[model samples]
Target: MFTSAAMFFNGAEEAVEFQCPVQETGLTATIEELMSLLQEGNSNSNSGSPNSGSEGSNGRGVYSLDERKRRRMTSNRESARRSRWRKKRHLEDLTEEANRLKMENRELKNRLGLVAQKCYVTWRENERLESESLALWARLSDLNQVLVAMQTMRSQY
Candidate 1:
């Protein structure tokens, strides 16, 4: 009865072996060499029997499709997290740029107002100088007429 049980266990082990394979990797490598082997095996099976390579194993070597799928899911989740972080950072940069532009616009407007005030002052000064010049010219003309009248009187004497 024990012999029969042992045979049954052996048969179950063989059946499980055909279904899946086990492989190992180092903690340092992020891209697993194990997954690459599984991919290659899948491709080779579709084409023909695989060539005997350096990664030697018994016929029908061990691998787990469910583990591969799980690894892919984890990688996808990490990629999505990174993408979300990048988008958030991009939005923050845009907001900062908009605030900077608004501040610059306000400063420019203030400078323009100052320039307008200075121009108004300059115009007023110019008008005052023009009026003073016209009055001086009129006074000079009256003095010239008086001098001519004096000269005429002296000629008569």
Candidate 2:
């Protein structure tokens, strides 16, 4: 059982030999005690306690306090850099949209001016045609009266 427990921790298939006497009845209690001790050690290390060995010589495999702090600072700087890049990209997109909208507005205003000019020209032409039509109708009426008077004089003679 001790060999099995050690293999679980090691995550390997190679059989481990234990010299200590481990009874089946005490297995659960032993596992629990081991887990508690591991938790306590992790907490102490994270809290930078005196027993956690803040000195450069923490262990052969463990990182020193200064190294861990440097790694955390580097990760934070990278995260902040990425956030700033995203913000800059978003701002650039908004600026591009604003520029496009301004150009479109100017084009629409120019088209409106052209339409207004065309409408004024068409209105003046309509008014001139209407005045010419009235003048032609009055001339036709006077010519009809002259023709009727000539026919009456020819018939009397």
Candidate 3:
């Protein structure tokens, strides 16, 4: 089934990831296509003419099981290292964003407290001015009563 995939594709999908599957002969078509491309690429890359080792009549070099296992282990280790580095970078970014938000929140609370204090001071000043105005009006009324009494006594005389 994998060999048949070479007919539909030009063997350049090795770097691509597989997601959905298309069913043909009850087999996942994308997996078959990916495997075919990867195998072709591997065969092409390893086809260098080797003078130190025997080359088969098919122009391909023979590979040992130990060499294949070593390559697989190396690839796995590199992949794991990169994955760890990415996770660490992501955590650092999140921590920095949280710190910035906390600083902004603190500044806003301080400004709110200052505004509330100013409002209370203005209210107290207005209340003091209102009481002073009432006291002045009462004194003026008492002076008017004394003037009226003096005018009445002069008229009696």
Compute each candidate's TM-score over C-alphas: 0.54, 0.54, 0.45
lDDT of 3 by residue, 1-157 (tens): 2233332111232233334334557557656767677767655544443322323446544444555567779999999999999999999998999999899999999999899899899899889988988898888888888889999989999
Clash count for each candidate, listed in order shown: 3, 0, 0
Stretches of candidate 3 exceeding 4 Å from the true structure: 1-65, 140-157
Give me the displacement of residue 143 in model 2, in angstroms: 2.3
Candidate 1 deviant stretches above 4 angstroms: 1-63
Alpha-carbon lDDT, every model? 0.60, 0.67, 0.65
- Clashing pairs for model 1 are 21-62, 21-63, 22-62
What order do you get sorting by lDDT, best first? 2, 3, 1
Model 2's alpha-carbon lDDT is 0.67
- Deviation of model 2 at 105, angstroms: 1.1
lDDT tens digits, residues 1-157, model 2?
Answer: 4422221111122233334444557576776577557655544444542233323444442344676688889999999999999999999999999999999999999999999999999999999999999999999999999999999999999
Model 3 clashes, total count: 0
* Cand. 3 TM to true fold: 0.45
Worst-scoring 10-residue span by lDDT in model 2: 4-13
What lDDT tens digits, residue by residue, belong to model 1 across residues 1-157?
A: 0110111112112211222233333432333344455555554433332232222344543334544467779999999999999999999999999999999999999999999999999999999989999998899999999999999999999
